[model samples]
Every structure is written in structure tokens, then in C-alpha cells.
Target: MVTQDGATVTARSIDATRDWLERNLHSTSIIETERFGFFYGREQALREVSLGIPIDGVTAIMGPSGCGKSTLLRAFNRMNELYPNTRAEGTIRFLGQDLLKADPVAVRRHIGMVFQRPNPFPKSIFDNIAYGPRVHGIRHRAHLAELVEESLRRAALWDEVKDHLKKSALSLSGGQQQRLGIARALAVRPTVLLMDEPCSALDPKATDRIETTTRELAQELTVVIVTHNLQQAGRISDHVAVLLAGGVLAEFGSTRTVFASPFSEQVADYLSGRFG
Candidate 1:
């Protein structure tokens, strides 16, 4: 067969192309996982998953329900341990450190997480943003204030909540609350941010704002987001990893390449809404 570029295509050629792309795309990755596996008791949620998240761009992990998209994202920061009987295998390296063996608290400090739903503390907006900093030992009021402002600004929420800093965070709209959650995560000054379907519960307008914030955040830190929305992934991700239902990574590459010409039939079918 021949591609639209008029180049002859064969199974061998396709494999070679994909292999080359994978090998070269993540040469300077900030996080690399090799033969990684995760188990919740006896059931494996992730199986031999391998991928590299670049240091300066948004990487979207996409898959159908129960495909371990969130499982892999949480593994980066050791969040999986929150569940009983959960364990990880193989290696996950973050900045050359063995992430699976690293101190969970320190790993979390460097890699912040934003969950599927906005979960702000039942405190004032300012307090919500200041909580992480306080946990990290920033007790000076002035310094905490500065960090709060900076974090909110980074989340694109400072302008809206600037005058309402004393108000309860729960009073904010769903979108605002989500942005507040992002701001709270940023207060710790993490090098990487992991978002698990952050916009899945928001409306289109809210999703757009989060996407904009994500793009801006990518300028300063590595971002790995788990999203089921294919369009959202295409819009915000520089790289995309598609996981199959059985905890397998079916295809991973630049967003353009994966969406336009997936190497795996499973990825193609999933992207085309055939099975997913």
C-alpha cells in the first residue's frame, strides 16, 4: 500500500517508522518508565507500560475506561500507594532517580497532582493556595501571600479571585474551584504536574480555560495529563500515549502523528470512536 505522501507502506516499514519515532522523540525526557507494572492486590492495573514524558511539553495519556490511564499518571508521584495492597514493578525514573523507590512525600512535592474533580480544602481561597506551602514549612505570612498570588496567577485565577481571597473556596464555581486546585498544586513549586481528567467534569468554557492554563504551565514545567477526551488531547498535548484496555500501551508519539497516522490498529479504532 501507499500513503498519502505517495510513499510505499508495508508492515515492516510501519514498524521501523514507529520505532524510530519513539526512540528519538523522548531523548531528553524528564520522566522515563520502562517495563512498568502496577497491581492493586492481585489484579494488574498497568502492565509493562513504557514511555517517556518530555521535560518541556504537555503529554496526554488517553485510553478508554479501566485502561489504567490514571494508574500510570499516579505512579509518577507514588500516589498509587494510597491504596492498600497496591504495588509497582519495574522502573520509573524521574530526573535519573528511581521514582518507585524514592521517598513518596518528596516525590509528591516535586510532582503535584490535580484530580478528576476539583478538591479544594474547606478553607478560604487564600488558605487553599497556601496549604501546600505551609506544609513545606513556609510560615511567614508575607512569603505565603506572595506564593499564593504567584500560584493563582499561574493558574489564571488571580484576577477573578483577587478580591475574594478571604472567601471560602467552596463558594467558587466548578471551573474556578478546579483552577483553585491547580493553584494549590502550584504553591509547592513542583517541577512536574500530573492532571487526571481535570476537565472531564467541567463545561466546554471551563475546559477551554483549563486547556489555556495547561498550555501556559507547559512553558515552565513538565505536564502529563490523563484525558479521555480525544479532542482535548489533540488541542493541548505535544505528545500522546494511548493505552489499550488490558493495561498495554498501544501507541505513543507526537499528537499529530498519533491522531493522523496511528501505528496500532487498536489505537486507530479507539481514536475513531469504534470501540472506546
Candidate 2:
């Protein structure tokens, strides 16, 4: 089960997926969608969209405001399930498991998410990072502490907040708080991270820090980011998927190719700043 462009499929067994990854381990895809569609009430938010997200790299989703970029991103982790009358059609495979059929909690555990705004819980930094592990039944204080530290380190916020683990998360700067949000997501040890306009709410410096952190995190995890900023998408992503009205995927390819030569006029127009 592989796409023509060499993107791996997600419907096979885990063993098959593992074998595929091992064989093409350096060329493995972490997630795959085939004819995926989504609906909000009677309105179709996405329609027959398909794409692949490679492992240990960034896949940026770019499109106009109503093109369903975020909708598709949310579907990857079943976040769409939270909304009533929202239905997803077709298959989404993550590490070879059907995301729509899999347990939502389990799907979320393996695919953590970060929102546009920094959403730290109203708790100390220590507790914030420890929340995921605690929910999964990890109660050992030492283990929790180690996980917190490791997650923070991966998120590149350890040095700044390590000394203040017990401090209120709200006390941190906007950039720091965003990193805390990322650290909280990483504490669960997710293999895929979904980011939705993560820098929209931050200042330039904070955005830079988050971008740096995202680059580092890609060394170990699959990253899918939805961003309005075409420049940011070109700068950070290895692959790019451009969406259009009715949630259609207009074009997808290597970052350089997509940005330099889009396949559709819509994509070209949006990228060229002609109109959304």
C-alpha cells in the first residue's frame, strides 16, 4: 500500500508498516490518507483529500481561510469527533491503524496536538507536563519527574523552566508558555505532532523560538503544521500540501517544488498573493 509518489500507506498491519519502515526506514511515511472527506452539519468541509506524512520530518498544510486546512489537521487526531454532526469519510492510517476506527483516546495518545494559542493548564509547570503520564497510569513520582524533564528538554524549554518546575505556568512568557504546551504534548511520548497555526499568537521572537523547537523536534517525531504564512511553511517543511475550497487538496509535493511551481492556478494565486 504505497502512493504513486512513494508515500507509504497506513491501512496495512503494524508489522507490515514496521517492515515497510524498516526497509525504507529512512524513507518511511508515518501517516496516510486515502479519499478522505469531512462534513460539518450539511456543509462539506473537506472532500476526497489524500496525502502522506513522512516520519521524522515536517509536512506543512497551507491554504486559504476556508479551505479546510485545520479541518483536515484535526481529523488526523480525531479532533473532529469533538464536534456534533461532524462526520469523516474514507480512511486515515497512522502507523497502519485506521484513525477513524481506532479509539479516539489512543489515536490522540500517539498523535499529540498543539493549538494556535498557548493553552497551559492552570497548574504548576511540573504538573502540566505530568498530566498525560498520570492519566495513563504512571504514578511513580520519579518516573513522572523524569518524563517531565525529558519532554521539556525535547521541547527546548528545559533550561529556562527546569529551575522553576513548581512555578505557575501562567507566569512564563508567551513564548515559554507555548513551549510548555509543546512539552505537555511530548510528555505522552507521541510519535506524531499536529500543530495548528502555532505561531499566530506569538511575537516574532517567540515565533522564531517555536520554529527552532519545531525543527529540533522533527529529528524524532513526525510533524504536521497548518500555517497561513507561506514563508514559514516553505522555511520549515520538507513536504507541503495545498488545500482549496470544499476541502480539496489542490496540490502536494516536496516543499521546494510546491512553492516554486504549484500545479494549480488557485495555489499559484494564493502563494503569489493575488487572492485567497
Candidate 3:
């Protein structure tokens, strides 16, 4: 049973959940949320949600709008604190450390974020990617250059903008700008990257490139993306977490299994385009 809270598993449900868990098992999650809740000054958002995000994997939080997808993603890096009076209850642990109690600045550095739209600073492309390293005290010009190039290559934007490193980042196309955003986040060498609708603003081709970059980055870093696009989730995610409205985690498992055989009626309807 679920009512403005998380699931209440009975004996029958437990067996089905266990079967899915067995099929989806991986290394212990880099992050775990247990009975987690969130609030904006007593206006509750998420409620009693539990999830485990495996290390070095791409886990997509799939749901319709207003389903707490972004809220949950922001919890990873403590980004929700940006709002006044916003707070969380229960626990969101990263590497066994409670992120709610962790230093927000350190947490952000350890887990970078990319937004829905490309948000590059009004600086040269090289400087944008180098800014994170600089803030972390990487001052050597040679080292900064190396990091810049590597980050760009990883984001798949190196060749396109290699000759124009000194140009303003805003001068790039929408797709390039988004890739640059990814590159900037990657340069920080985050343990986990949180992306909130990174492709929502891009065209089809740009979305494809971002998907490719996400997959490649997952090879080395844990990635958690919040996207409403089910096809995109299936294409880029190893595992999927489906959140129902009112902050309930309706279903979660391998991307294929979740998409192929959703655990609940709402999940199945969402997947079938019956209701967002």
C-alpha cells in the first residue's frame, strides 16, 4: 500500500520485489536514500522514499513533471538548500556519509550538476571548463590546459571547438553549449554527476550526443539523471527509478525490465503513453 508515502510491501509483493532486486543487483550503491522526505517550510514534497544508486552506473530517475524527479536529483548534491526554508528528513547517504549533514560546498564539488539548459559562464570555452580546477587551486597553465582538453574530449566537443578555445562559450550552438556544460562538470572529477533534464533543451541530434557522453562518463563515474523522456532513459541508463506523483518510488529495476514489465499499473500506463 502507498498513500502520500512509499510502498508498504506485503508477503506477495516482497517476492516479486526480491526477484526484481536479484536481477538488478550490482555493487553496493554509491548513494542510498531510506524513508527520505523533503519539505519547503512544511509544504511536503517527497515522502518516505527509498532508493539505492549503484556505483559507476547510470541511473535515470524517470517520471512525469511535478513528480519530485528534480527534487530527488537535487538531494544528491544538496542543491535543494538553495531555496529558503527548504529541508529534508530521513537520510540521503553518499559513501555512507549522510549528505544532509555534509558540507554543502564539498558535497557539490564531489557531485557536480548539469541543468536543463546550458549555463556556461560568460567566458572563453577553455576558461569555463578550467574554472572548476582553478577554484580547487589548480594554477599551473599546462595542467589547466590538459584538463580542459580532456574534459572537452570526454564531452565530445573537443574537435568542434578546439580551434576556438578562446571564443565565448555563448557563441557555440545550443548542442555545443550543453556539451560544454557537461565538460565543465566532468572537469571537477565528481564521484557522481547529477543531471537534471540535460537534454530537455536540445534538439534531437544534440540529445543523442549528450546521451553518448553520459554513457561514456558512466564507465568511470556514477551518474544520476532526471529525465521525463522514457526512450532517453532506456537508451542511456543501466538502471531506472520510476517516481510516482507525491514522491513515491513506484518501480525501479534494470532499464529494460522496468520498461518491458513495469511493476505497477501507473508505471505501465506512463510507459505506454497513457498518462504522463
- On a 0 to 100 scale, what is the lDDT of residue 210 in model 2? 92
| Candidate numbers sorted by TM-score from highest down | 2, 1, 3
Better of 1 and 3 by lDDT: 1
Q: Pick the candidate with the highest lDDT.
A: 1
Clashing residue pairs in candidate 2 are: none
Please identify model 3 stretches exceeding 4 Å from their true place.
Answer: 1-27
Residue 2 in model 1: lDDT = 12
Give per-model TM-scores. 0.90, 0.91, 0.89
lDDT of 3 by residue, 1-276 (tens): 111111211112223333443456432677899999999898877988898987746999988888899999999988898899987889987766778887777778778899998999999999999988887777888888988998899899999999999999999999999999999998866667899999999999999989989998887677899999978998899999998888888998889899989879999999998888
Residue-pair clash count for candidate 2: 0
- Clash count, candidate 3: 0
**Clash count of each predicted structure:** 0, 0, 0
Candidate 2 regions off by >4 Å?
1-27
Q: What is the overall TM-score of model 3 with all chains considered together?
A: 0.89
